[model samples]
Target chain A: MAALRQFLTLNAQILYWTFVAPFAGKPTVRIDAIFQQMVRIGVQAVPMAALTSLSIGLTLAMQGSHELARMGATSYVPDLLSITLLRELAPLLTGVVVIGRSGSAITAELGTMKVSEEIEALEVMSINPIRFLVAPRVIAMIIMLPCLVVFSNYIGFVGGWIICNFALDINTTKYIMRLIESADMMDLISGMTKSFVFGWLISVISCQSGLAVTGGAEGVGRSTTKSVVLCILVMLVVNAILTGMFFIIEGPKG
Target chain B: MSETKRETVIEVRDLVRKFGSRTVLNGISFTVEKGDTMIIMGGSGCGKSTLLRHIIGSLRPTSGSIKIFGEETTTMSPQQMEKLRLRFGMNFQFGALLQSLTVGENVALPLIENSKVDPAIVDLVVKMKLELVGLTGFENLKPAEISGGMRKRVGLARAVALDPELLFSDEPTSGLDPIMTAVIDQLTMDLTQKLHMTAVVVTHDMASAFRIGTKMIVLGAGKRAGMIIAHGTPDDIRNSPDPEVQQFIRGEPDGPVPLKLAPEDYIDRLLGHDRDKGLSY
Candidate 1:
């Protein structure tokens, strides 16, 4: 219950400093730091994200075709593969990967700063620690998570295409047509929306864990582990709720 | 003692802090006058560092008031407190220099963040402060690359970069060799005297405290947690009649501050009679 209150309070502070309070000319946001975080959070994670999405995509295609061929419905392989990857796998898998990589790193970095008294030093220097240390990272996560998801979605589709054309003996034209017809614009938007929320969750939870750290080196390690676990767990729960909400609102047109 | 009338810069009244059920600071009060070096001395866990943190607005007291430059800090908003903090500087025990930034960049941080000074002017000020702390050519190196003594000096340079009205140092000589401790003490004295800054320092080093402190307070332990057992000039502290104060100043092992475990308890444990059944080592 104490942890819940701290999380909510930290999130409220982050929201105000990042969005609402900045308009008052205080300029809580630092563009340079945001840019640096983007490179760290988004650009640097590209290869890993692409590789994971490709592997998942190929496995989904191979498994789907094997089952569908037994039922003599092999033509439905592209449709199943595209819909599953677009509506669920792309965003969820991307979130898990980033949580393991970037979320843990962010927590460790800030936790070390807390242990070293750098955070207190900033405060003593009349600097707002949330604005100076957290805002840029949170903003970068919000902006970059979706961008990475979009890249993952594209790479995942290509991976499916390669598997369907060669291993499944399906024509490229037929696979493209079925995939295009099976998934709609709503599927893409809903997936991207989930990515955005996941990004916010990862950044906020990691920052909170980092700032709440005590002890020393042991505390940092503990906080980093907790950040990754909490991020993944929260993303899973949020993913289910969001998927349901989008299903209700968009009415399952695809 | 001195002919000049001194104005009070910091006035802390009945400050108390409790962590859970354990009270760390208990009704501590003191006043620091402008241009005075007020040394806060205590053995480990005596709340010396905690008191410094409360005065600097890093930790809030459980009860009582702290007026800095005549403004009540306990009731100030974060933004308001930040503005107030602009007039003060704090040097941490471990230097607390940002590992990512170079020594020069670390010193230049306050100038960059608090003002829109020209880049060249910032560089000049950084160079000047580094030189004052005897770290002129070590500016480009990261904190991890420097020695502990050098890191402390860089921290001092950074603390005085803005020429703040008040300066707070926590264990400035804690980890240094005797010579390095003297050098840091000299630098601290120079900065306070040259800049006319009111300073509050927390340390257990009697030698360093005596050399730099114009006035001093020593905290008491146990049931009198965080209470000041002694407050006076260096000479008065040196000649104090209080056993605890004398024991601390003389660096004696056998003092009023009790050892961790009593001899009877140790013998009881050795006899396999556990008084603390819940404790595990």
Candidate 2:
């Protein structure tokens, strides 16, 4: 009961501070720090994101084409691939990729800072960690994740199109034109929404894990892995629930 | 140049810190004078580090007052408090060097962010601080490339880089060899004295504490049945009339604090999840 109380109190503080009044007024954020953090989180995560998106897109196209051909609707593969990539697959895969790749690293970095008392060191140096360490991350994710999701979504579409055209004998131009005609603005919005939330979730959850960090190297490692796995799982579960809600709200089609 | 007479830089009165049901620091009070090395000594889990944190304003006191350089800490706004914190320097128990940053970069960090100090001059200052700690040419090395001792020195360099008027260290000699301990103790003394800085060290190292602490504060239960049982010069503290302190300073290996061989009794206090997690370093 004590532990549970402590957890609730902490979470309450996190919610109030992060969403409500952590700081009463805005402070001028260091542009350089945000850029540096962006490089750390987004730029460094490219290869893994690319690889995951490519595989998922390729597999989806290969399977969707074979399945659609039975219904004599193989030409609808482009529309199918585009809708799935923009509305669901791209955001999910991109988020999980970032969670596995950079989420754990973020935990370890902040965890090491916590364990070595560097967080205290920052306080001694008169640095506001929320503004200094955390704000940069939150700001960077807000700015970069949407862009990264867009990139990933585009790459996924291209990968799927390439597979459909070359491997399954569909015309790439027809695929592109179909995507343009059928994929609505909502498709992009939903993908971007998921990506944004996932980004916020990763940073916030990893930071919380960092705060809970103890021991030395081994402890840091454990926290890092835990933060990543837990963040991914939570993101996926939320993704599932939100998707179901969205499908119900948006209905079958307009 | 003539040396100025040292004055008290830090004063604590009726300081208290509690973690829920358990009170870690209870009504502790002390003063750390300028150019004096004050060591806070206690057994494991006796709140030495907690006391240090309270003193540093990392954790606020539940009640009572703390003044550093004569400024009341708790009254300051967060930004105001942050500005005041810049005047103090501290080396953490685990030597909080950023593993991703090279030693030189780490040492130059405060200068880079807080001030418009030139990078070249900052680099020079870092090298000089590193040399003072006997860690001279390892500037380019990442923290992972160094030994524990070297990491501690790098941390010291970074701590002292800003030329703070007060330096705080937690367990400065905790995991070091005897030789390194001696060197670090000497370095701490030399640096503090030369800089005319006051130092407060939280340590379990009796020899280093005795060797360096101009004044020492012993935190434990039962001597006077209180938190801070002894606070005086090392000589005075050693010869204290209190039996608990006598047992401590003499290293008698038997006291009310126990010798860790109580067996079944120790296991009886096992926190099940913590039991699985084992003892922490």
Candidate 3:
């Protein structure tokens, strides 16, 4: 209950700092700080996100074809791969990648700052740690996670296209047409929405864990491990619920 | 013509702080007047740091009053406390600088964030502050690149960047060589005398504390823990009748100021048993 309260309080604080505080004449986080975090949380994770999505795409294609070929419907690979990547795999896999990469990094960085009294130093300097250190990171994560998901969606499609065009003897035009037809804007929107929530969850969870750190180096290590595990678990559960909701809202689209 | 009163910068009254069942600060009270360098000295874990935190509004007393700049801070909101904090600066024992920012940026932080100082002036002020700490022209180095003494200097530079009316330093001279300790002590004295800034310093270094402190208070240890045993001028403290005060100032190990554990307690603790009830071999 205390943990939940801390999370909610942190969420409220972050929201106020990011949205309401500036209009209240409180200093908003600097653009450069947000950009710095964006580079760290989003730009730097590109290679790992791309690699993860590409591998998932390839494996999905290979496994899907092996099963579908038995049913003599191997040509449907593009439709299935595109739909799965758009509606689920891209956002989910990208979130996991970010949890492993940026989420843990945020926790470790802030936890070290907490143990080292840098956070208190900011406080004594009349600087709000949330406004200066956390809000920018949270805003960056929220903005960047969806962008990575969209990028991952395309990268996954490219990986599947490779398998289909070369391995399955399917033509590029046919594969592209099948993918375009099978996936809708709604699929992209739903997936992006999920990614957006995942972004908020990851950054908040990581920052909360970091800020709550006690002890010293071992405490930072513990918080980082806990942040990653919590992010992954929360993402998975939230993904399942979001997918269910999307299914209900979109009504089993064919 | 009436005489002007020395303005009270920090007035802490009967400040009490407890962690669970252990009382760390017991009815502590003190007042820091403008231009006074108040040294808070104690053995390790004697709650001098805790008292400093209370005075600086970092930690609220369990039950008591802390007034900074004549405003009661015990019940002040965070925003209000922040507003109050702008008038003062604090230096941590370990520098506590943001490792990510360069030394120059660290010094420039409060000025840039709190004030609308022009970027050029901010740069100039950063250089000036660093120079005051005798760390000229090393602005671009990361905190990790700097030595411990240099980091402490940077921390001091950053603390006085805003030219605050009051400064709080926790173990500013700890972990430094004697010459470096004196250098820091001289800087504190300069800030107090030249700038007319009030200071509250928490430290165990007797020489540095005596050198810089116009007034001093020594927190007790062991049985008398968390209570101020002596409070007066540096000379008065030197002639204090309390054995604990005499022992502390003289840096004597054996005295009436008991160690954290007595012999029986230490034996019991090592034997993992209750006091006077440990298993006999």
Candidate 4:
């Protein structure tokens, strides 16, 4: 119960600093800090996100082809792979990857700062720590996560095409046509929407854990571990709920 | 008697703080006049640091009134307190320099954050403040690259960058050698005197405390913990008759501080028994 209350309070604070407070003329958000975080959270994360999505795409194509061939419907491989990657796998896998990568990194960085008294130093300087330290990272995550998901979706589709054409002996022209025909804009939109929420969740959870850290080195390690685990768990649950809601609103595709 | 007519920069009345059931600061009260160098001295965990934090508005007192420059800080909102903090500077024990930023950048942080200063002017001020702390030409170096003494100097530079009316230092000489300790004490004295800033320092170092303090207060330890057992000038504190104050000032190992536990209590602790009769171990 305490944890829930803390989560709600943290969420509200982050939202106020990032969105509402700026509109109210506070303008506490630092553009330079946000850009720096974008480089760290989004630009540096491309290779890892791409590799994970590509591998998942290849595995999905191979497994889906095997099952479909047994039913003599092997040509449906492109449709299955594209639809899954676009609607579910892309956002979910991207979120998990970032949770381990940037979420844990954010926790460790801020946790170390807290332990070192840098955050308290900021407070003493009369700088709002939430605005100076947290809002930028949260904004970066919100902006970058969807872009990463979109990149992942594109790469995953290409990986699926390679597998369907080379490994499964499916024609390239047919695979591309089937994928394009099966998946629509709504599939992409829904996945991107989930990615946005996942990004927000990861940033908020990690930053809150970091800010709440006590002790010293041991506390930072604990907060890092907790941030990663909580991000992944919450993203999974939120993904499930979002998927259901999106399904109802947009209806299932393909 | 004439001191009462002087302007009070900080007025702390019956300040109290508690962590759960354990009261860290009892009903403590004191006043710091303008240009006064008030040193808070005590052994470990005597609430010296806690008191400094309260005066700086970093921690809230359980039941007390803290007025800074005649403004009631205990009842101020965070935004109001932030504006109030601009007139004061605090030097933390461990330096608290931002590791990611270079020394010059760290020193210039206040001006940049609070005021719309030109970048060139900011650099010049950073250079000047660093030089004031005798850290000239060390501007480009990160905090991790500097020594402990150097980091503390940098923290001092950052603290005084804003030219605040009041200054607070927490254990400025804690981990330094005697020479460095004296250097920091001298620097602190020079800065306060030169800038005409009211200063409050928390330290257990009797030598540093005596050197820098015009007025002093020593916190009592044990059951009388957090209570101010002695308050006077440097000479008065040096000649204090209170056993606790004398024990602390003389740095005696075996005095009123109680170095050894009683035999019964020692045995009970060793056997994992509760000190109180009704409590289970």
Candidate number with the higher DockQ (1 or 3)? 3
- Each model's TM-score, in the order given? 0.93, 0.81, 0.96, 0.94
**Can you tell me the DockQ of model 4?**
0.67
- DockQ ranking, best first: 3, 1, 4, 2
What's model 1's lDDT at A254? 32
Model 3 ranges with Cα > 4 A deviation: B1-4, B258-280
- For residue B25, give model 4's deviation from the true position in Å: 0.7
Question: What is the per-residue lDDT of model 1 for residues A1-254, given as tens digits with 9 covering 90 to 100?
Answer: 99999989998888888888768877566789899999999999999999999998888888988899999888898888777887799999999888988899999999999999999999999878898889899999999999999999889988889888988777889888998998889888888889999999999899999998999999999999988989999999999999899879978573
Model 4 C-alpha lDDT per residue in residues B35-123, reported as the tens digit of each score = 88999998898889889888888889999999999999998999899899889888999899999899999999999998888999999
How much of the true A–B contact set does each candidate keep? 0.85, 0.71, 0.94, 0.74
| lDDT scores of the candidates, listed in order | 0.89, 0.80, 0.92, 0.89
Candidate no. 2 TM-score: 0.81
Off by over 4 Å in 2: A1-36, A166-169, A184-186, A214-226, A233-254, B1-6, B74-76, B174-183, B191-194, B221-226, B255-281
10 residues in a row with least lDDT, candidate 1 chain A:
A21-30
Can you write out model 1's per-residue Cα lDDT over B1-281, one digit (the tens) per residue?
35587778999999989999989998888899988999999879888988999899889999999999999999889889988989988999889999988999999998988888999999999999998777889989999999987898888888988889999998888788888788788877876788788889998888889999999999987766789999989999999999988988888887687655698877676766874675455
Quick one: best DockQ, which candidate? 3
Candidate 2: deviation at residue B58, Å? Answer: 2.0
Give the TM-score (0 to 1) of chain B in model 3: 0.93
- Which candidate number maximizes TM-score? 3
Interface alpha-carbon RMSD, every candidate: 1.0, 1.9, 0.5, 1.3
